[model samples]
Structure formats: structure tokens, C-alpha cells
Target: MLFDRRAPYDFFSVYHVPDVVTQRQFEAGIAASGWYDYFEQVNISGAALSPVGALLNNVALLPPTPQGPQIPPVSPITKQRVNVLGRTMTYADEGAGVPVVFVHGDVMSSFLWRNVIPHLDGQRTRSLAGDSDKLPDAGPGTYAFATHARYFDAWMEALDLRDGVVLVGHDGGANVTFDWAMRHEDQVRGLAFSEAITPPFDWEDWPAQMRPQFQYLRTAEGERDVLENNFFVNAAPQSITRMLTPAEFTEIVRPYAQPGEDRRPTTDWPREVPFDNDRSQTRTALEAQAAWLADTSIPRLHLPGVPGGIARLGGRKRRLISTWPSLIEAPVPGLHWTPEDAPHAMGSALAEWLRSLIN
Candidate 1:
């Protein structure tokens, strides 16, 4: 009486009848059969109907049950660090083909490009985002562009990344890249900048609204405010349209969270606003970079973010963009953190642009 004799697919045909009628014994007997093994292999997802045990077909080949979306797990990233020019620099090297180097701005490190580098496939792209907070102090009044440029140049040399390498710089790092492009124009194949600062524009010329903010950052009180409050680290995650997850925020802010005055780079950066054309290293470095931007024949890309925000290039940037006929300006959607805020758009555009150059 336990068998449904009239059923089309008889369950008893696939399973052996056991003398013991206990459900556990029945299951064990069915499990030993090849048909039962085949059914077990077929994954049934979603809610299975009771009584008749009906399952809606999802994957047609297998007798389907209700199921949720299958999302693949993401691979973990591995960070690489090296002693370049006596300072420890961190970067991520991935993919293959053309060599592209990514440089990050102050208050941020290579982690900024986490969402972008993967898109630059078919090329060996290394995102170099060193934490200057941990670097040895280069004495008081030392300008970041001059000091960091040396470190960056040394890093390139250490890696034997000499000539024909594409350089992409973001925010303050653009200044460093520009300085290098000017000094060693022959070494670089092309240049790309996003939310960058191009000189000839001084703190005095800074937008009326932002001048006070910069002025405050020049003070000792500002240094305390920045460190105690985690200004750079906290600001970036919040400023973007898409707020970063807690884990992403933790990784980005890790370097700046370290104790001691070595973290002076955070405050030193705001103080080094290239304004005067006098003997100031800041002025000299920026002016030279400006000159390079004006004259270099190298292919260039500029991704201008929304104006008026923390890192978006404003009027000065637009004016500079106008003069460089060879520089290709690509519009990106975002304020300061284009890589994080607009990864898909930025990455795909960048990849297409780079491919065009290669072909």
C-alpha cells in the first residue's frame, strides 16, 4: 500500500522495497540507488511545494526548484610593498600587456584605484599609492611636489619603469606626475589626470568659498583638527555620492590613522599650495609642470570631475585644458573620488582610450 501503482514515474521503480518500513530506512535504501544519486546532484532551489513536491523549473536540464541569484565570490587583493628611495611605497600590480602606472594624491593611497585597475586589462597596470604619512620628514617648509616627486621618480627607477610607460595621476598626485613629465618628458609615453591640480593658480586665486578652508589648514590648529578628527580619511568616504562600505573605508584610512608626527604629510600637503612664483619650491615645481602641460606633445587624458568640490579641477583646470590641444578631455560623473564614485564609467572610458592609443 506504500506504492503509488498508477503514477507515471514510479518512485518504487527507482528505489528498492525494504523490509523495514521506517522512513529513515526507506531514505537509506533510496540513497543507495543511482536514480536517487542523480536526483541529489540536481540542485532544486526556491520553495518546493508540499504534498505533490512540485518545483518550478529554473535550470531546465535539471528538475528545478526555487532558487536565488547566483553571485560569484570576489577574489581577495594582495598588496605589494618595497623600499624605493629609502621610503616604503605600496602598490598593486595586476593584469598584463602595456605598462601603466597610477599615482594617487595626498591623504589617499593606492587603495583609491581598487575599483579601476582591473578595467585596465591587457596591460600590466601598477597602482602606486604610497602613504607619505609614514615617510621620514623632509624638514620643515619642504614642499610635497618637490619631495614626493623625488620619491616617485626613485620608485620608477627602482622598478626599472623608465621609458614609454603611461602615467595616470589623480588629485595631488597629478602635480607629482606633471613635475616628472616636465623633467623627464622623454621617459613618459602619455599622461592622464583626474581631479588634478595644475599650477599658475595660487591659494590667493583659489575660489572665494574655498580660500578660508585652505587658510585654516595652514595653521597648527588645523593640523590638530585634521589628525584628531581624521579629516582626510573621514571626508573622502562621505563626500562621494556612493558612500563607501565600512570595510572599504577602513582600508583607505588605515595609513593616516597611524600615530606620531610622521603623519605630517596630511597637514603639510594643504600648506604646500603652489601660489607664489618666487623661490618657493612649491611655486617652482608647479610652474614647471604648467609649462610642460602647455608644450608637451605626449598624448594626454583629463577626466574633470564635478566642479566646486574638494578635488575637482575648477576654472584653472578648465583654462589649462583649453590650451592643450593634444590633451583629450573625457567627462566623468563624480565629484572628487571618480574612481570610487564612477568606477564603471571611468574604467571603461579609460580602457577604450588606452586601447585607441595602442592601436
Candidate 2:
């Protein structure tokens, strides 16, 4: 996995040096630190380790500018707004032929698929993103899977989308898409997912390095950290292969840059993670969907990223592909955010996979 759970190696030796320390002196101190020694012992020499090594070097040297290519701007496309099930939804509806529906996960909107959508060529595609309606006001039933599946199903139904509609989902959207497919498989033509979460796994199963992050988010302190610092917008960019351009960074962070109910989605998304199993609606719904994906005969595509993609932290046995005989695994290069990191590669893979399904 190119971006596995990074060890919490404290590279704080440079910080301890006097404020007047020269760059060369700082480098000398860092090189002699135990943290640097530990990383030096690890064999980080390959395409898989390049990004990791770069990140480490960046931390050690504190470069004034990024040393890698910057993420390109999202493709140009006009966004349209429409009311779906009483909520105003933003989307891009274009092209013609088979319908391709793109569903985005938390901390992001449909803009996530901007680059990939244009590369889809002749196919008609619509990305339903931006502010979503609050999960139905139905008591404690406001869980992610059931709530999102209900809203998504209604949105598709409103659009009159039925048989032969291609479905593509990312991150949390994967869970929502899987749930929708389980209940409405007959309507879907093909399903493609990347960075999806499937279980028999939970917070405990997360890598030691990442477990703390997940666990902290379950607390009020974590919510404050996210809101005050715009954690998703700031931290997520690091997962990409290139640095985000100033404009691109601004666009991605715009949705959550403010301190209001607008940031609620980012805060709520993590807490709702089905890290613990209970008869809760989220858990029950995810459990059912996980089983369905394993056994479903529907045409499916699994776009795993370089080094492991979403399945990185989780081992092979715990991955959805372990039991999904019908899924076609196409390994592409990128971290969790494949669209930003490897848009061309992702687009080609998606277009090729869809064509194969038709053939």
C-alpha cells in the first residue's frame, strides 16, 4: 500500500534546536535523531515508498515550496441545481447514451469526480453532490447507510433512473451505493467503487497509527479539532500524490471553511462510522450490504489504488474483494483520493471497465 497507516514517529528533533539554528545545522540534528535512525533502517526504496520518503524528507527539511507536481484544476463544467426529495442537490448532468451516476462520500461533494466525469466520453453522467438533506427526521434512525440509501434511492427514483444505469461511488458513497444495489439490483447496470469501507472490521481493526485518529473523532474534543482547523480539507490533501494548487485547495475547503451548521456534515460523518457492532441501523444495514456484495452477481468493478487504495490499512482477507467473485479488480496509482492523485489513470480504468461490461 502506497499510503498505509503511517507510524507516529516523532520528528521533533528539529524543533528542539535553538531558533537561530541554520538549515544545515538543523539537518545535521535531524539526521542524528533516533526517529531519523529508525526510518533509515526501514527499506523505503521503490515506487511504493517514494511518496512516503518524500513526505518524510519534507518534514525533516521543511521545504519552502512543494517539490512535486501540483494537482491540476478540476475539469471545466457547469454545475446545475435541482430539488430532489425536498432538498436542493447540486450535480453535473451531461453527455448522452447510458446514464452514469456518481455518488461522493463525506467531506466532499460531487466535485470529487470532476476530472473523471469528462473522460467518460460518450456516456451520460450525473454527479449528485454538495449539501445533502439531513437524514430523515425519523428519531434515532438517523444512521448513515439506511439514511443515505433512502435519500439516494429517492433521488434516483425522482430522476426516473432504472435499468442500465451505471453507478460509481467513492468512500462513504460506496456504502450508500452498495446498500442501494442490495435493494435495487435489478435497476443497476454496473457498479464501481473505490476507497469503500466494508466490515467484519471496526475502529479496533484500524492500524495502530490510525486507531487514535478514529478514536479521537468519537469525542467532543475531536469535533472541535475538525471544525476549528478544517481538518478534512487540510489533512486530506496530504493523501494525494501531488500538492494541491492554491485555487484547488480553496475550492475543496470552501464547503467546510466556515463555522456553522455547514460544517456539520464533516463532523457527523466520522462519528457515524460503524466502528462498533450493535443492532443499530447503520451496523445492520452495512452488515447486510457487505454480505450482498460478496454474493451479488451484478457486474462490479473494484478500482484499487496503487499500494492498496482503500484496502491498504485493511489486509487482503478483510477486503471486500476477498469474497466478491464478480468484482473486477483494476489496480491504479494513487492513494485514497485517486481522483486528485491519478485522475487520468482512474478515468481510463473506469471507461475501459464500463466498456468491457457492455461487450
Candidate 3:
């Protein structure tokens, strides 16, 4: 259940399961390919990270590595599908601790967290020189966010994981996390939202002073042009995009453009919307989610950053600020949006916030 930037068609969704016409059992596959030496690395996290001011916290944890032939069957890289509402949601897990699920944001799969997982795990080893001890890079506790939209809520319960859990959500994912937290607050120890999102129709219109700074709502030609003029045209980095090699540009844009296919939709959406091309409905849905979580009164952690330009105008002004009052501002107001933008001014402030959590 690892995340990859593959097309939704490449992803096997629960709605349409591929028939096991001639399936090779896991055992059979293992027997045939005895040369199993490269499973993914796992991390075991051991410290609490302060939510304030770090672009990325250097977490102390073990990392997961792909399995080798000599590794036993129950090695860290092993993952299996458990039944959830009669559907099989595959998950990859490692180590043992309070379960924390890693959720991905829009245009990203759980793959984004692959690097962060290693930074927080809690296992270690001592150097033969007896100089110091350090955690190995096997991985942290089992963290997975590998299901499509509908099954996520149910799957969380089926896993019967730790009683209290911490969840991390970014961008579009904040929508899902917000809904789930409201429904299952007892299960969530902490909630985190990055670049908070809400449906366009759901947000309070920008104050008139800020209206010209943003243009949204495109259900019609007039509104569409408004979004195109203020949103897409300004949002899409045509200049930077054209500079990329054809392959590079295509790989990045294609997923959002065609999705499952030019006509096929994926990830719970009914139709494959060429949002990269359409750029419609996205803001609408985002605004709705944003409205719902507009003031998350719960204790939470928020880390927000993205490519500069359009996102800030179209999204940052309304979404980020509207979404995290309860969690972010209330907890840490002193950190800057971009540490690089004001590093010197925010150095002690950010470090103090992060070091507090790490300790």
C-alpha cells in the first residue's frame, strides 16, 4: 500500500476489483523469487516534534528498508490487506507504538511522507567504536494512508489500531481529516492540517478590500472567466512549466490533466475532470471543505508551505488563514510563512518552537 504518483487507472480501486483470473499466491511468488533483498525501509519514531517554525523537523526514528532474501516472512516490509466493509484496503506497516496514519494532500500520494517517516521512528544501534548510539534506518511505526475516499473512515476502525492516534493531513487531505476528526474525535490524539482547504461555495467572500486580490466561483461563463483570469491564469506557472523538459512537464501535469484517463475519473470523483485543464470545481470543493474546518477548535499542528505565486493569491489568502485558527494561530503565532523569506527574524522563534517539541 505504498504511495506512488501513478495514474488512478494504475491504482486498483475498491469499486472495480481486477479479477484474479490466474493469481499467484504470495507464497508462490515468494518461493519463485527467493531473491527478495530490496523491500522498502521502515522508521521507528521516538520523539515529539514541536509544531512551531521548522521547514522540516529532524525527527529521531528508524527507517524502513526493502527486505532481503534472508529476512524472515514477517519482516518489516511486509504488508497485507485486511477486510473493511468487505473491501480490501492494503496497508504497509512497521515497528510497534501508538499508531499514526500518514495522509496525503491533493496531487500527492502518501509517497510524500516517505522521507518524513524515517526522521521520527524510535529504534537505534550503538557504534562498534563505542562512541555513540544511533537509531537504525528500518522505519517508524506502521503508517499508512493508502485508501481511496469512501473506505478511509471505515478502514481506520477495522485496523483496530492504537486507541489514540495522531493524523497528518496536507492540502486537499485536510478536508478528509476534518470530517473524520469530527466523527471520531476520541480516536484522534492530535490533528494536523497543511494548506487547509475548503469548498469555494462554502467560504465567506473575501472582504471587499481583498476581493480584487482574488477572483473565484466559476459556475458560469462570467464566473469562469473570473477564475480563469484571476485563478488559473495567475495560478498556473506557464512560464516555469514550459521551461521543463517535455517529459518532466508531462509527468507532473498529466496526472491532474487526464487523471484515470481523458474520460475516466479516479479517487472517488465520478468523472475524470481535467482539472489541470478545467481548473473548475476544484476551488468550489476546496472552499466547502475550508468552510467546514474554518475554525478547528481542536488542539492541532499546522505546517503550511507551497510553490510561490498563484497558490497564495487563489488559495493562501482565503483557505490557509480561514482553516487553522484553533490549531495554528492559537498555538504558535510567531513563525513566518516562509522561513527562507525571513530566516534571521524567525530563527530563534522557530527553533524554540521546534526544540520544545523535539525534547
Candidate 4:
């Protein structure tokens, strides 16, 4: 029998098929059912095992584990603090090899990469995810993208990470990554972005429904929403695929719990968005970044979530791929917060791309 006729519950719960079943029977049954080949291909391609591969590997009846190469047990993530730009910066540094620096976007800290970091090849890459200075409790400073980029530089200098660094960014983090990379192009080995803010950010490009919301964010009413009502923190659940458990939601909003100027980073980041023909420093930096992204020879990767949040509003993906010479597109299924929803897919694609850079 393909599955244990005696224990149907075991098959459903633990994916356990008794060893008494012949390998051929199991393989035949797996082949008869589609998706086996898809997982096999994902494994063969050197990406981390998908959810189905995890299930197949649990079966004692299968010989020669089908889930590609074995992944080492992920080490527990430990938070470390370092003084950067005269302020204490929190970051998670684990594994060892070529450095892959992960920069998170607005309203998120290094915590965002908790699931994604382990998917990287621990043997071949060192993962560094830093909480920017703008985040609550990270110390006071101007929360502009340029200031954040400078802090990124200082943090790297403090760590002595001068060269051969791969930058991975999301949302506001992506903008910081682009700004930092543009200034220190020689130090960056590769770039990866998900739900990022790229160039040609015209007001007309924004979706009609989102325009009013963004416009509101640029006003005093938006400040009240963020500071007093905790709008962004409360609305975060709507951006992702799954509901955040009570503990999860609490942990995410913990930093911003206190009211007052501590929440300025959350508010200021939205206003920094370059809409229309604005002549702000943010716009100037992005204009310069656009030119660099177009001409740079460094390998670039763009992982767009299917029907992504921000990048999906306009023809952002199409424009980015067309403009960037070395850009590689890898689409994962999710919404805005891909790391929260499609962690495995996002991490696998990131790992595969990072591997390509080194080999």
C-alpha cells in the first residue's frame, strides 16, 4: 500500500508512512499525485526545502531524503549592541562567510529577518541585520533617509565591514540600501530588494485609492494618526497574509507603545516619500540613485511579492527591470510583508541568489 492503511491519522498529522510500505509504492503514489516533482525541482535547484519537502522528509518510508541538501540546525538569534554614530545600535549577527547585511524598512526592526536569515547557507554566508537609528529606543536623530544611510555607513565602519558586502533591503530599508550603495558602490558586492521604493516616483503613478491616503499621511492629520492613535502599528496586520497572534502583535508594537516624539521616526518616514515634483533632499538622493542603479555592474536581485503592496501600485517592477541592467526578478507569493507571510519562499530565493553571487 502507498500509505499505511492502518493509520490514516498518522499520514495526516505527522506525514508518517510506515517503513513496511515499499519505496516503489510510495514513489509511485507521490508521482501519481502532482507537487512531488515541484518540490523535487526546488530541492534540485539548491533552494531551501518548501513546505511539501519538509513533509516528505518526515516520512520514515522514504529512502535518500528528497529534500535537497540538509540544512544545519539554525542557531538561536542573539541580539548584540554596538555604538554607531555616538548611539547604541541593536543588530543580529550570526553565521560566518561573506557578509550579507539586511536593512529593514519603516515600522520594522531587525526582527523582520528572524525567519529569513536562517534559510541562508550558514556555511557560506554571515547574516547581519541591523536596527536603524530611527527606530524607537535606538536614540534620537534626524530620521531622514540620508541620515539613516550615514548611520549605516558608520555602523559598517564600526564593524570594519569595508568591502564585499551584499545588501538586502525591504521598503524603507530598500531606499536606505540604495542610498548607501550609491555612495559606497565599491563596497557593495550585490543588492536585493523586496517591496522597495525605487526611482521615477511620480505622484500620478500612485494608485487612485492610495493617493488620498498618502496625501493624508503628508499632513498634520497623519501625524495624529501615527502618534496618538498608533495607526501604522494597528494597521500592520492588514498588510500581511496571516493574522498576528496577540503576543506577536504586542512584540511588534512594543517599541512604539510610548506616545510622544519617540514615534517621530514612524511619522517622518512617510513624509520623506518623494511625491510629485518636490525638490527635497530625499528626491535629490533618489534621482542620483536612479542613475547609479541604471549604470552599475553589480549583480542585483528584486523579489516582488505577487500583487505586492507598494511596488504593485504602479508599474514599478516593470520599470525597475527595464531600467536596471543587472537586475534579476524572482517573484514570491505574498503581499507587503513577504517575510511574515512567505518566509520560506523569500528566504529560499534570497539564499539561491546569494549563492549565485559567491559561486
Candidate 5:
């Protein structure tokens, strides 16, 4: 069997080489071609000789199958646009059945969910991920949580999605989702969060190593970094465990390549983060969402990661899991950008939780 160590596979494929001579020739050819390190050969006989069945009996000798849902390659999603609050918003509307809207946080667009949305059961669920009005590609708008939440409401209205909608948010998007859910509880069916920044926590709760960067982002120097040098776009790699490929990095920073006032959303978002029990509007909205999250009976899912960025710290994650009565926790392997680092596991957990809400 030919196996690519990097590919995601739920099962092993067994190829029947008719004879030992051919097998030796194949091995020799692979070794001669200098690709021997990438290929492995396993021999099976007797009861395992069901070549037609395409099943291996001696599984112990084979490489372990990947756990969790197998993630597919990122594909091009047809971009759809709609006018929401006088701004043209870009979104990806795919699949059918129950509606699940995905909201991205700062420095990212709906493209963040490109790999994730594919894992959902398309026939049973409709996946919708949109770039918020504040995003560079989505046109300009106010960057406050309340304003973003209002824009979300208008986006929903423009799309004619009023009921039975599952709202999933990451980072700042979580705050907006929470705000929208609080005001229109009747319209939302469930909620899911990853690296969410709701339920305002103390500044000390942030990762000690990352505190300096976050603090800097809230300063004048940071504003220059964001507007002139595309700091947030370049710093995205720090939030995730894996290094993004050149292609991926290029695609992510393409919208914010030029230096100008247009990068205001990136700068404004960092400043909006509350610290030391501040009385800012962002803090107020977060605190109110925290209260609603504690009291609401709406089904919720928390897709936290190990050593996650921001809100996924040990105490914060524990509080979220313990305090929220109706929340389900599905921990994945990643840092801050769980969606980027563990899309298969994150998507599978989210799909399962979403299915439960519908059933």
C-alpha cells in the first residue's frame, strides 16, 4: 500500500502485488528512485489473503489510522455577496437543511472555515460563513461589539435566516455571537465557541508570554504596526501551532497588503479588549453575555484546545465548562486557532453538536 504520512486517512488501503518477485522489484524501484523513505511494505499471507475484500487482517503491522474526522483539502468556495447595513458582505453559503452560521474573529475572514465547513454533513445541514462588515473585504464599518452584532442581525435579515440557526464563533466573533444571541434568543437554536473572548476575564488570565504582545497592540506603536506594517496579518502564525505554508500566508494577508487607514478594524479590535475590570463598552457587552450564558438554556458547544490562546487558559476554560449548565466541551489539539490547527476534530465535534440540536 502506498501511504502519504501527511494525508488524513480513516482506513488503510491494501494493494495485492501478485508475487514476491514483483514486490522485490517494486521495492528495488522505489529504493533506486531515492523515494524509499516515503514508502513502506508489509507482507500478509494465509487468512489475510482476501485481496478482493481489500481489508487487512494483520492491522497491527500497519501504520495507525488517523483519529477524528478526516479533513479534506481546502477547496474553493463560491463567494456570495449581499447588502447588509449598507455594506456589501461576502459569505460562503453551501449545503442544505438546518442553517449554521460561522463568524470569524480578527485578522481573518470566512475563509477561516474553508476546511471546517466541508466536514459537516452537507445534506443534513447548511453551512454559512461570512466576512463581517468590519473586515477589509466586507467593506468598512464600526468595530465595536454592539455595532458588529447589529450588523450580524442585518446580515441574517438580508439572508432571510430568522429561525433554527446555529451560531458558531471564534475569537471576537464569539462576543458578537453572544451579543446577537442575547437580544434575539428566540431566533437562535444553539451556540458554539472556540477561543472565544466573551465573559470578560481579568488581564492576568492571558498567557504570560503573550501578554507583552497584547499590551503592545493596545498602544501607539501597535497602531503603527497594524496600519503600516500589517502586524496582525503577519503575527497570525504566533496564534497557531503549525507554520502556515507560503500559499496560505499569502492568501491570508492579501486583503491587508497595502498600508493605510483601511486597516483601522485590526487596530480597533485589539484596543477593544478589556482589561483589569475596565468599564468600556466591549467589557459591558462581554459581561452581559457572560450573565446570559450562565442563565440561558440554549444548547452550547465549547471547542477548546490544549494550551489555547486567550480565553482557553486553564481557569477560564474550567469556569466556562463548569459554570455554563448547558454547554458541551469538545477539546481538540491546538493552541489559539483551533479551527486552523484542528479543523477535522473541531468540525466533527461541531457537526455532532449541531445535529443533536436539530434532532
Candidate 6:
């Protein structure tokens, strides 16, 4: 997105940006500028947005109309597609040198890294694989995209993430980052996790969980609706249980009605991606993590003290923070249970941690 020349000021969404481009920044600096208006800015989550979609109008793309005035100059950040994990992955990259793979968590594509991606001081690059879409649904029972971001090696082929990398993860993504270090300890220079959770459940201390979640196959006739409804309810953020307004309760969430190809929900995922492999193979793979953490000696960070996340759906456990602390001697910075409560602080801590690497 480029902001050629200038115009009026605007802050239209909950996404807070302090980059002061409010036509005032341009005018007050060297010349006087015009007034403000109520033109609503557009927004769409990146994973759901097409590169050509209308919402590409991030501040970088807002243009100066022929009749209207222009402001300060800005340019579109050129994008690159690298063959990491076999697929031609689209990503944003800048800087150079020892790389850091800031893997995004499930439900969110790469958009969650937006704040930290732009703040690195030097010699660093970030890349993301647009692998969020489910594998072509060949049949009812066969599902892919099952939070497979958990695998580090296979995914690297699809993304040109920094080689010999620093790995970072948040929430469910923490397992991916730490697990990556375990598998590729030599390739990894350092590891950082925020709001991380590793296996070993402590349900005894859990707040009231409504009930066990269950799923039915697409072949099951009437049960499909029941399966879909409970699926999303389990994946919902705490806000759904707390602050979500009635309208939000409906419009924001209620759409998991057996999603079709077009009208699908990905902003917040519904559950652990349906496991694609046989139950035996998948369980063996997941259960190997604790053993791996017990062995990982790569420099690490464990960030806990964040809001609780959806703990379980069916029988699989959510990331349990207490299960893996041996990996970190000094805990990463943040308050317990509400770290993401302040993104600026999280972003800063992440930036500083990465810089601390090879410094």
C-alpha cells in the first residue's frame, strides 16, 4: 500500500496504529493541509482477503483522488513467493541475515504477526506460507489443513523462511515453535514462545468447562448440524463467554452451520483440524512432543500468563502452559494469563528477544 502525497485524517478501526499519517502529519510538518471527513475505511482479515480484494487498502495503498488532495509518500511493500514446504508460499520480507521464522498460530493466518514484522532493527526477514486453506475436500471424511503448521521441517519447503532460523510462536503456535527447535536443534539458533501451552493437562484446576465436545462425520445425516454447532462453540474466544454482545453472539459467531466452499469461517477456527492420518499415527506423533521438549537444549523462551484458550474439543487437549517450563530458565516477559492483553508490550518483548539472538 502506498500513500502518495496526502489528504485528511482518519482512524477507522479497533486495530490501533500510531504511525501518525493523519494529513496533519504531512501538513503540520511543512505545509498546512485540509480537514477531516467520515469516509469509512475498509477491512478484511488477510487469510480471507484476496490480494486483489477491495480491502487491500491498508494505509500503504490509500490513494489521492484527482479532485481531492494528496499527502506524504508511501509505497507498496513488494511481496515474494518462496517454495517452502513444496507450495509457492506468499509472504512479506525485508532486511537480511540470520533468519527468524515467526510462525503464525492456527485460526489466524499470518496476520497476527503484523505488529512485530515491521519492527525488527536489522538483518532479519519474515516469511509466511498461505497454507491456511483446507486441502481440496476430495470426500467427506478426508480433511487436511489440520493445524499442520505444527510440523516445522515439511512446512519449510513451502515457505522461504530464514534458514538457520530463530523460531517464534504464540498460543497454539508455541507448540510448533518449540517442537521445531526439538527436531531441528542444529538449524535453530534460538526459540521464543508467547502464551505457549504444552501437553500434560491439569483439569482439576480448570474453571467450569461446559462439557465434552464431540463431532460426527459428514455422512451422519441430522447429526452434522449438531457436530458443527458444538465445534465452533468449543473453539470460541473467551469473549464469547464474557463480553460478546447479542449481535456479536449471532453475527460474529453463529455461522459455523456446516460451512460450504464459499460461505466458510476461518477468522476463528472451529476445532483441531480433523486429523487426516489414522488415529494411531497421529497420536504417536502428538505424544512425542513432551519427549522432544525434555531433550531440547536450544536457547528458549516460555511465555505463559496469558488469557486461557479453548482447552479441549472431543478428547484432544489445548496447549497446557504448565506442562513445559523446564525448557526455559528465565520466563519470557509478560503478566500471567493476560500477556496478549497488551500487544505493544508483547511485540516489544518479541522484537527484543529476537535481537538478543546473535547480538
Candidate order, lDDT descending: 5, 4, 2, 1, 6, 3
lDDT of 6 by residue, 1-359 (tens): 97465434365343322234543354354333223343433332111112322232342353421211121122123456655434455555656776766665533445445444555645364434233333443233232223354435555644545357877676556666665666667787777665444344333322243223222322243234434444433344332212222433343333333454312233222233223433443244445765676555666665443223333212233244334444442332222222222334455566666666766
Give model 5 RMSD, 1 decimal.
10.1
lDDT tens readout by residue for model 2, 81-123 = 6687778766677676777788888777777887787677764
TM-score computed on alpha carbons, candidate 1: 0.72
List residue ranges in candidate 6 displaced over 4 A.
1-79, 83-88, 123-131, 138-152, 158-163, 202-237, 240-258, 261-280, 307-340
Candidate 5 lDDT over 1-359, as tens digits, reads: 99765545444556555445665676578679876466564433211122211222123243432433323334478888898877889899898888889999888888789878887865388899987544445222357666777788899889988888889999899878888888889988999998878554677777665677779987788878888899877877766654455666677776677786667777677778888867887787788888888999998999887556675546664566557878888887566788877777788888788768887
TM-score of 6: 0.55
* TM-score, every prediction: 0.72, 0.75, 0.43, 0.76, 0.78, 0.55
Candidate that scores best on lDDT? 5
State the RMSD for candidate 6: 12.8
Off by over 4 Å in 3: 1-78, 123-149, 199-296, 306-323, 329-359
Per-residue error for 68 in candidate 3, Å, reads 27
lDDT of 3 at 98: 51
lDDT of 3 by residue, 1-359 (tens): 97574443432312211222212243346456753364432222211113322222223121322221121111133345667656455565544565556555433333334333433345221000000011123122111122333456766767764356656564445556766776666766666544444333322332232233233322334233422233322222231211223433343344345312221111222121112234444444444445655554555665544222212334534345645555542221111122222212222332233333334
* Runs in model 5 lying further than 4 Å from the true structure: 1-74, 133-141
Better of 4 and 5 by TM-score: 5
User: In lDDT terms, how accurate is model 2?
Assistant: 0.66
> What lDDT score belongs to each candidate, Candidate 1 first?
0.63, 0.66, 0.37, 0.72, 0.73, 0.43
Preferred candidate (lDDT higher): 1 or 6: 1
Weakest 10 consecutive residues of candidate 6 by summed lDDT: 64-73
Q: Best candidate per TM-score, number?
A: 5
